[model samples]
Every structure is written in structure tokens, then in C-alpha cells.
Target: MDENRKIIQVLIAICSLFFIIVGYLTYIQLFRSRDFMANTYNRRQYKIEENTSRGNIYDRNGVLLAYSKLEGEEQERIYPYGALYSQVIGYSSKVYGKSQIEAAYNNELLGIDDLSQVFGMVSGSNYPTRKGNNLYLTIDHKLQALGGELLNGRKGAVVAMDPKTGEILALVSSPNFDPGAKKLEENWQSMVESEDAPFLCRAAQGLYAPGSTFKILITAAAIENGMENEVFEDNGSIIIDEREIRNSESKAYGKIDLKKALALSSNVVYAHLGTELGMGSFMDITNRTGFEKEIPFDIPMSKSRFPYESMDKTDLAEAAIGQGKVLVTPLHMAMITSGVANGGIMMEPVLVKSIAHAEGKSNKELKADKLGRIMESDVAEKIRVMMQEVVASGTGHNAAIKGISVAGKTGTAENELSVKKKAKEHSWFVGFAPAEDPKIAVAVIVEYGGSGSEAAVPIAKRIMSQYLSQ
Candidate 1:
């Protein structure tokens, strides 16, 4: 009996072990198979991938930005523009992981992700993987260079895009690094530790409090909700649930219309508007205007966030003027301005214009897509007039250009942490030129760089003039 019992126990243990093995394999197949297939560290496949060359990358004007070449039977990635377009045309090293455009467009550059196009091969059968498709970006190299120059030496970012078509004209971030440098591997740790964060793509990834730049959205929201012709008395600041929301300079404009209030950037008036709209109505406009939505672009970007937890009247008041947990990327803010400039129709921002394949299957041009409207056409016109007034005779006076009707809003965002320490404010500006034609929309942010008119508007002016001149 004892011998029989021992044999039965051994058989049971073996069955249990077999089930465990099956379960482990199932888990890997269900959850981790795709990652394993795309792992770049597979040394055995490196030689095979080397033979399949990565494609070249170019700007809108057909200038080569990145390309790959053969080096001792190994594929070598090359970036010709150096640090000027570093953040946009990122490095793809076998040793170091990819970031920015390199990683974002990696599949297209490798040609591995083009499975549907596989049947277009010479024999209608994809035997061996072909070279990756070349990419033509929407970036205008000249504008990118000017943007880099304007933001140089300062910790900030600049983004310029076509308001109507959603094509990104120029995107730049200060304190850039050369992707071709051999020392990136050695200095990677220090680079990450640096105060300026040279490796970070500030234009798309860096988040900041928008300040009165948000007033544009607030004013648009007010108009959309039957408050366009509303009047508010501004005494510099207003109180909500005992919390005071004050203007930038703390000066009062006794009685004002929405346009004058926007021109003066009265926080009190905007805060009152927010409360009048209330949290539900305010959040509705926020969602409608592309907040908390995925920004469809060639390169991945951080989305602008509006926290909706623990709602109250004070929170609404603070958020109305772009304070109290409000954060946005420069790219996101540029799109917001673009929406207003393009007559309330927001377009999906595009960077990659086309993909070129040697298989005679050149990809189609990127079509402009609507990302939902932010306001009525008439409302956009009213806001445009107000923004024009801002540049004409208000806080954005310095933004005005000769023979050009510039529509813009200036913002001075106070740092939350530094409010107690009385630190410098971040300067901000969102503008579009030739107000009637509206060619380009720009967003500029200067870190701890005084007021928007002095620091940020000049940068926007130069960028707008450069594009409009062209």
C-alpha cells in the first residue's frame, strides 16, 4: 500500500509541473511576444539588420538631415545638421536607445512595420526585407535655424506651425546637444544631471504653467457659452471661496469688455468668467480645445494636462488664468494658437510629410486632418480682434511689427514653488501674423525670463516675420 501511494504522489507532482510549464509559456505568448520580436539587443540578428540599411531623412526643402551608411559591414547612423536640429532629428545608436524622431519614426525607417506594403514587392512576395523608407519632414530648415538662434543661451522653447494646414514649420529647444558626438555614451550620466537638461526636447516635452496665455482659451470659452457681449468690472483681482486671483501687475481696469479685458490680461475678469461658466462648463471647453487628448504628430509629445479632481470655485478661478496645477508643452500651446488663428478649426499637427521607398512605392503626402473645432467662426473673429488689440496697444505692444497686423497674447506665469521665494516669472507669448491671412502661429516660453513683452514677444516677432517674409 505504501509503495502504491508513493508512485501516485510522484505522478501527481509530474502532472502539476507540466501544467506550470504550459502556464508560463502562455503568459509569455500573450503579453511579451511583441517586445521580444522587436528587441534591438539581439546580437544574432544585428548582422542581418545591418545588411538592411536604414533610410535617409530630409526636411521639407529636401535637405538631408539624417542618413545611414555602411561601416565595416555594420550600419552607421549619421546626422548632418548637428545640434541645431538635434531634438527633432535624434540619434539612433546601436549602443544607446533612440529618442524623439528617431524612435518615433523607427519602424518606418527600418521598413519592418510596412507589412501591408510587403505585397508590393517585385515578385508580389516579400522574400527579404528591403531598405527602410526615407522620410520627408514638414520642417523648414531655415525657420528651425532662426528659432534655435533666437532661443540660444536661454532655457526655453519655440514652436511655429502653419495654422491652416497643421504643418510644423519650426520646432526648437535651447541648450541642445550634438547627436553625432562620440562622448554621448561617456557623458550620458552628466548630461541627464545637467541643470539645463540639454538632451530634453523642451518644445514638445517640457511642461510649464501657461499664465495669461490661457486667457485666450478662457475668453473663447466665455463667448461660446453666451457670454461674448458680457461685461465685467476688474479691480485688479477677484476672490473665489476666499482665494484671491490677481492680475500680472495688480492694476485695475475699472470697467471692461471681453476684448479690453483680454488686451489688459485681467486675471480677475477671466477668473469671474470661469466661475460663471463653472467647473463643468469650463472642463467641456477644455476638452473641446484639445486639452487631455493625444496630439497626433510625427514625433511623440507630452499632452497638455488639466487636472479635474477635487473641483471647487477657487480651482476654477485659478485655472481660468492658467494657474493652479495647469501645465502645457510649448507644442500644445502652439496648436491652441493655431486653432484660434485658423478660424476655430484645429488641425492635427503634422511633421512627417512623406515616406520614400526604393520599391517604387513612394508613400502619399500627409493629408491635413481636422482635430475638432474649438469655437464658432464668429467667436474666433472676436478673439482675433482682441488679440490684435493686445499687440496694438496692450501688454503685447512690443510684438507689433510695421506693415503687419499681429494678433497675440502675453503671459507672465509665476512659479508655484517660487511664489514664496519671490523668484522670477516665466515669460510667454502666443501669436499669429497678418491677422487677416494668418500664415503662422507661434508659441514662445522663456524660463524665469521676466515679462512676456520683453522676453518672449521679441522671439515670436522674429519667428513670425521670418515665416511671413518667406
Candidate 2:
């Protein structure tokens, strides 16, 4: 009787162990399969590449940027425009892995349908040989090409967008590398080691001192705080905590209001205003304008930084004029300019416009999304008028377009290049065309390209003209 009971207990334990194994297997197949497939280190992606054809990436006008073709039994990805769209489309390599949009939308590009994935897992069938979905980007090929041409291998970035919709028209980061370069694997180490940093996406990821371009935000804060009409004496310089701040060339302006102060890009007046508005007010405005936070972009972007801790009078004075620790990306600057152009309502920046399935059916279409209001409509209008004056007779005269009313601000931001030599300031320009009815907004930065009027302004002007002409 005892032996029979022991046998029964052993049988029950074996059955429980079998049930547990089956349950765990079922859970992995149903829930954890996608995670495993998406892992970059997974060897399964290489297998998927062999069986499935990757999707093609296109510009807004249907110009092919990237596509895959079968060479013998192996798949090869090709970039038709080479370096023009390198940073945007990125690359997908078995050896080096993926980046940018190629990594962000991997599943969509692989056409890994959940139902089919499950069926393949359960049945142990070969992966499907269908082409992945097509991605249509918001980028204008002509504008992108033009922006690259303007940069001309310089270490800088250009960003142009529709002010109202936030549709990115052109995003160019110079010193770009060709993902399809012959002997790419051989050149990979050098490219990675190059001081120019071809892999860096300057348009979205590069951060720099905003210089006077940031004054636009300060002006907004002053207006919201009921200080727009306040007057200040600019004797070319101001003393804050015994630290003197001066305008370019130390050219003093007599008593002036906010509009004239911005038009002239007066460092003294802005420094005074920054100290008066206080650090709390400045932080509030910066937070609203997407600083100190990761801006949601189609690809990865570095957050624009601002001093979150309490600042003294000298720090506040410098921060007010886009100095101190305040840093901004070219894309963010373009967005802020667009917000002012859009009447205080900033829209979310968008890149991919639509996606088409392999079966020639539209799968998804992205639309304009509002970020939030930065200020009152009336205040934005006042700033708009001031920006227009900037182009008309202020420091941004070089940015003026023929028969087009342009609004803009120029920035000559100080930066350290080397300990032994004097560094040429970074040139910056942010503006929108047809001021009353803006169509295109642009932000341009030229690294070590002294004088905003000389380097950045002309580039921005040409970009705006090119887009508006079309």
C-alpha cells in the first residue's frame, strides 16, 4: 500500500513540471517574441535580412533615398544620394548595427507583422520574402541638397521648417559620410576617429551657445511679465556684480525700448533686462520653450540645457544674452523662431510624412501636432515686428530678401576652440520670411564662422529664398 502511494506522488510531481515548462514556453511565444526579434545583438535579424527585402526610403516628392537589392542570395542596402541624407536615413549593417530612422522604425521597415511572426514561431516556417513598408519623409530633396551645398563641407548645420505646421523642410549637417562608401568597413575606424565627427548629427544633436538669438525668448519673458515698454540706457556696456558686459564694438545706444534693443542686438540692454527679469522668470520661459527637456523628434535629439539651479546677478546677466551655460540645438532654435512666426503656438517637429505598405496601400500618414503656446498672440506679434526691424535696418541686414519682408536676428556666440589660439565666434541666424504671413523659418549656425552678418545670415537668406521661390 505504501509503495503504491509513493508511485502516485511521483507521477503528480512529473505532471506539474511538464505543465510549468509548457506555460513558460507559451508566454515567451506570445509576449517576449517581439523583444527578442528587435534586439540588435540578436542573430535572428541577419536571418530576417536574408529572407525579407527591406523597405525603400523616399523624399517628399518620391525621390528614392535608400533601397535594398538582392546580390546573389544576399541583400545589399543602397543610398542613392550618398552623404546628402546620411545623418537622417542612417545605415543598417550587420557588423556595425543601425542608427537614426533605420533603428527607430526597424520593425516597420522589416515588415514583421505580429500575426505572421506568431505563425512563423508556432509553425517553424521560413520568414516571408515580402518587401517592407515604404517611408516618405517630409524632407525636400532640393532644399536638402541646397543646404548641404551652402555648408560646403564646413562644420555646421542648417534647419528649415514650415512655421505653422512644423514640417521640417531641410535638415543638413555638414562633414557627412557616405553610408554606402566602398570599403566602408575599412574606413569606419578613421571616420569614427576624425575630429570633424562625420557621425554627429549637428542639426539635432549639436548644442551651442545661442548668443543673441536667445534674446527672443528673453524679450518674450519681459513682455509676459509686463516690462515690454520698459526703457534702458545702453552705453555699450553694463556692470553686473562688477562684471562688465559690452555690445559688439562697444557701440552705445541712448535710452531705448525693448523693440530697438533687440533690433540693435544690444548686449548691455539685454544683460540689464536679464538681471531685472530674475532667474525664476527666465527659467519659466525657457521651460515653456522646450529647454532642459528632451524634445520629441522622429530621431534622437539632445536636450537644450539651461541652468536649473539658482543663479547670481552676473550669471543671470550673461544667461539673458544667450551666454553663460545656456545651450540650444539648431533645430530647437528653428522651432522657437517658428513658434513666434506661428503666433506663439509652437508645433511639434515632424520628419516622416507617410508610410506605404509593400502591397501599395497607404498604412499611416503623420500630421501636424501642437507642442504648446509659448506666449500670448499679441506678444508674439510685437516680437514679430521687432524681428522685421532687425532685417530692415538692424544687424541682420544681410538676410534681407528681394521683394520679401524678412524677419530675423543675428548671433555671434563666443566659443573656445583651443587654449593657445583666439577662437572665431560661432555665427548664428534665426528668421522667417514674409513676416506678416510666414511660410518658411530657418536657423543656421556656422562653427568658427565669425560674424552672424557674414556667415550665418547669408546662408539663412539663401535657404529661405530657395524654399519660398518654389
Candidate 3:
């Protein structure tokens, strides 16, 4: 009887251990992480993932971006374009885990989401499901390549989207790492240690002060609130709430209208407008434009912030010109520009265009959805004219594409908080092309880069030229 009791106790312990492990796996699969690609907790799971199949990823034109292959008993992932789409398409690897689209839509690629496929596997299937499915993104390969090339070795990000359709044409971040390269672990470690942060999707995650590029928002607010005809003179600088704010370099025009103020990016005029408009009006306009909110997107996106509460008179003035607690991502700026191009309606930005099953089934297409109308059409038209002047004859002249009629804004964002303050300031440019019938809206940011024209506009020019020409 004692021996039998011991046997029973051992059996209970084994069952308890099994249940605990199963519970942990269920939690990870259903809640913590999706798909088995990232879970490396057990050797058996690792072996299964190593041998399992994954979907192929392609650009809008069906150019292969990523695909999987079976090498003996192990599975290998291939990125044909190397670092071009490194951050956008992401990599599916057993060692480094997953990110962006790879992890976001893992189940779709694994065919687990399809009930028919699961039943086939359960009901004694003879044929194997090695190739799961295919995902086609909205990104254009040539445009994406142009973006990566334009970034060059600079530490910055570039984002381009279709103003009408809200399709992301190109997304690129510099200081990237090749996931398919040999010694990926070593390379990833180096990227992790780099100051530029190659792993960061700068277009969506890197937040920075918007600088003069923020003047566009202020201009929109002014126009929408019946201040389009309000004229103010720029005597180099103005005093607001006991704090003096000057124009860029303190060289201001003696007299100017609202259009001229925005064209010249007159800080004094904008700071004064901020004080006049007040926080109540500012919040209403900004909130409508989707500020301080989680922008719904196919992949993860960081929130664009507008710190309105607890702001004093001086803080309000500073925030108007895209400085002093006004932080935004490149993606957020692109969307704002897109909103202006789409006549005040902000559409939900989408990356994945369609998904195709390996069983030759019908393709699932994702349609565009309108987020909201953030501004009045008349107000957007007025600001559009002002932004056009900026590109045609003002600070953003460098962004002018030959015969394209571009409307853009330049920003030399001050980087005062960085430990290496003298390294350089963040340069920014946001704009749309073919202003008469807007098609593309873009935002460029070069960290520690010089003036907006010199650092960011050239990149914008090249990207727009490539996309529009095509």
C-alpha cells in the first residue's frame, strides 16, 4: 500500500507539471506573443518552428521582398533586397524574433486562421502545407529603394503616402541592419548599441520637436478659425506673456499678411498668433487633426502629442511654432500633410494591400477608410496656397520638383536637450506634390541634420521625383 501511494504521488506531480507548462504556452500564444516564430522557450517548439512554413512577402508590384525556403529539415528565410525593406517588411527569424508586418499578421501567414486548413491537418491530410500564404504590401519597391538611397548614411527617416488613397508608398529609416546577413546576432548587437538606433522605426516611433514645419498646423488653425485675412507685421520679434520670440535669425519683414508670414515662416507672427488664438481654440483644431491620439494603422504607431494642459501663455506661444513640448513622429507629420492634401479628410493609413492563400483561393483586398474630416475645405485650400508659396519662393524652395507645383514647409528643429547639443539640429520638410490634384504627401526628418532645405528637402525632392515620375 505504501509503494502504491508513492506511485500515485509521482503521477500527480507529473500531471501538475504538464498543466503548468501548457498554461504558460497558452498565455504566450494567445496573449503575450502571436505565432510560434518568436517563442523559443522550449527545444521541441524551436525544432517545430525551424521546420514550419511561412508566407511570402512582396511589394505592390509583386517584387519579392521576403520568402521562405526548405533546406533539408530546417527552414531558411530569404530577403532578396537585403537592407532596403529591412524595417518595413521586417524579418521572420528564429534567432531575432519578429517585428512590423511579420509579427503583426503572423497567423495569416501560418494558415492557422483558415478553418479549412486546420481541419485538413486534423483529418489525416496526406499533402503538406509548407508554403502558407502570401502578403502583398502597398509599398512600391522602386520608391522604397529611392527612399533608402536618399537617406544614404544620414540618421533620419522618410515617409510617403498617397493623399487620396492613404496608401503608404514608401517608408525608410536610416542606420539599418540586414537581418539576412551572416553573423546576424553580432550585427543586431552592434545595431542595438549604435547611437542612431537602427532598430527604431524612425518614421513611426522616433519623436522629435517639429520646428517650423509645425507652422503649417498653426496656419491651418488660424485659417479655420476665421483668421485668414488677419494681417500682422514682423518686426523681427514679438513679446508674448513677457517672453520675447524672434523670427528665424531675427531678420523679419516690416509688414506682411498671413500668407506672407507662413511663406516666410515668421516665428514672431506665429508666436503672436498662438497667444491670440489661445489654448481653447488650439486644442479644438489640433484634436480634430488627430493630435495626442493613437493613429490607427496596419502596424504599430506611436502617438503624436500636443501638450495643452498646464501650458502657460509662453508655453502656448512656443507650441504654436512646433516647439516647446510639441512632439511628433515622421509618420504623424506625413498624415497631417496627407490630410491637407485630401481636402481636410484624414484617411486611415494602410500598408498591407492584400493577402493571398497558397491554396489558390481568392485574394483578400483591404479597402481605404476615412478616419475623419479634420479641417474645413476652404481652410485647407487657403493653407495650401500658403504652403505652395513656401516651396515656390520661400524656405522650402529646395523641395520644389521641376514643373510639379509642390507645396511644402521647411523646419530647422532646435535640439537643445541632447547631450551633444552642437552635433546638429533635426531638419524637417512636409509637403504634397501636384498641388492642383494632390497625389503624394511626404515627410522627411534628418536627425542632427542642418537646415530643412539642406538636409531634408533634397531627400524629399528625390523621393517625389521618383514616385511622381513613375
Higher lDDT: candidate 1 or 2? 2
| lDDT ranking from best candidate downward | 2, 1, 3
lDDT against true structure, model 1: 0.83
Q: Write the per-residue lDDT of candidate 1 for residues 178-216, one digit (tens) a residue.
A: 786365677787888998789888999888999999999
Q: TM per model? A: 0.86, 0.91, 0.87
Off by over 4 Å in 1: 1-45, 71-73, 113-131, 358-361
| Candidate 3: regions farther than 4 A off | 1-52, 114-128, 359-362, 417-421
Of the candidates shown, which would achieve the greatest TM-score relative to the real structure? 2
Model 2 lDDT tens row, 398-420: 89999999999999888876223
Candidate 2 lDDT (Cα, 0 to 1)? 0.89
Clashes of each: 0, 0, 0
Give me the displacement of residue 15 in model 3, in angstroms.
25
Predicted candidate 3 versus true structure: per-residue lDDT over 192-272, tens digit per residue: 788868778888888999999888888887886788897788899888867888886799797788888888889988998
How much is 317 displaced in model 1, in angstroms? 1.4
